[model samples]
Target: MHRIAVLLVEPVVGFDATIAPTLFGAAADADGTPLYEVVTCGLSRAAVTTTNGFALLPAAGPEALATADTVVVPGTRYAPARSDGVLQPELAAALAAIRPGTRIVSICTGAFVLAAAGLLDGRPATTHWRFADDLRALHPEVRLDENVLFVDDGDVLTSAGLAAGIDLCLHIIRSDHGAAVANEVARYCVVPPWREGGQAQFIERHMPADPHASTAATRQWALDHLDEPLSIEQLAGHANMSERTFCRRFREETGQSPGGWVRSRRVERARELLETHDLPVDEVARRAGLGSGGNLRHHLRRGLGMSPSSYRKVFQGS
Candidate 1:
């Protein structure tokens, strides 16, 4: 099994620290075999304090990192990294023990640690939006995009605050074991299986004055009828609102234009078909409302860096 070591720096963001172990620990093969061995480590074998008014006793010390296939750093209030973009000697020594080429992940403000260690320099990453400016000022070499839920740059990954860590974890699970295993773990955890990493970390949506005027119902309807052409006027009619109002409300609520959202959903549907069915590319595209095989190939290549046939081969292990 692959080994994952979670390094909990002092003053850790409690919720962020548990996400990896919880999500990765829940992943198992169809025959009930666990997919990964997850262990928690710290600078030393000591009680680590957290921002949540509690502390955690890690299962191991920095030595655990030397053998990990992957290392995760959860959000922390450790000042040197969080504010000064510098790693303290002890923490630096601890991180240096990690093997070269091992995957590294950061959740929320944990990106600070990675940035401080120079691990994120010239790499695309993200962190809690509230601290994005601070991160930028502290480490200008890092490519920081605070708008998205997560940024997966091959061996290095980072996520925005709080729940976005869940999205990143599920993404890793999907990448490692395929969507089916990830979906099963998601079902067990009672969370959505997928949220595109490019989705906004936060949307400034105001509550609709009239509940019935909201475009939620229409969005659900759109999901149900993705196989059909969905015009803005038709969707507005379903919500009993004018096209302009519908468009405004839709963007406010979902942080994406209706057309963009629809296209993403169609691409997602195409991916599901590719994974679960042996349908031809053109048929998959038509059923996904993407028009044809040529279009499907274009979307898949653009979104996933692979063609439809390659996607199927990977996800279905064919």
Candidate 2:
């Protein structure tokens, strides 16, 4: 079994401490057996107080670091001197105790701790968007991308604020378990399973100011007819324009091509039903408009590099 050690520093916030165990601990094969074990550790084996006024009894100390396949540092209230991007000395030493090549993850301001240890130098990472500017200024050597929900840089990973930590942890689960197991874990945790590293962090759709020119109707119509054979020609006719003009209009409205938008939504729907229902894969294919499990497998592989059964295994609501 894979072992993950979550390092809790002083004044551990409630949110970060809970993400890893829930995500990693839920990983299992079809037999309903555990695939990974997560241990919560601290600088020492002490009662670590949380920001919510609760105290936690850590199961291990920094010695856990040497045995950790992955080490995670979560947000703390002890950021000082360096402001939003500072790390305390004891926390720094605990980080230093981690074995080399151990995958390191940071939740919210925990990126500050990794940054201080120089682990993030010249690496792309993100923290909470609210403190993104400060993180950038403090560690410009570490490329700070503020728009992604999380950044997966091989050995190191970093996430946005509190809830995005959920996304990041789910991502790590997906990486470790393949899409099947990760999807199940997401269902168990009530989170999305496989948001890619490149997805927009939080791009809100702009409601049409001029409803007359809006693409909402076209999008809705496409969703309603995902099973039917629909193409740019059909959508353009619905919009009453040449295919080329309709294509331009669609991209302008959604920041992605019509095909890309349709594909993403299909995958999204497939994911939802996979997590919420136990329908036969072919039925799921029909509902998601992917035709057959074979076809679903084809597209899922092209879009997510996994099969439908595999994706369902990970994302299914447990």
The most accurate candidate by TM-score is 1
Q: By TM-score, how accurate is candidate 2?
A: 0.71
Q: Candidate 2 residues 1-318, lDDT tens each? A: 889999887788778888888788878888998988899998889899998879988899988998999988887665561475666677667777788889999998788878878999999998877778887888889899987778988899998878788888877776565556677888888875555555555545445466756677988899888877778889888877788877776766655678877776676667666666888888888888777888777888876678777777766523
lDDT winner: 1
Q: How much is 103 displaced in model 1, in angstroms?
A: 1.3
lDDT agreement of model 1 with the native: 0.92
| Worst lDDT 10-window in candidate 1 | 204-213
State the lDDT of candidate 1 residue by residue for 215-248, as single tens digits: 8888889989999999998999999989999999
What is the overall TM-score of model 1 with all chains considered together?
0.96
Worst 10 residues of 2 by lDDT: 199-208
lDDT of each: 0.92, 0.78
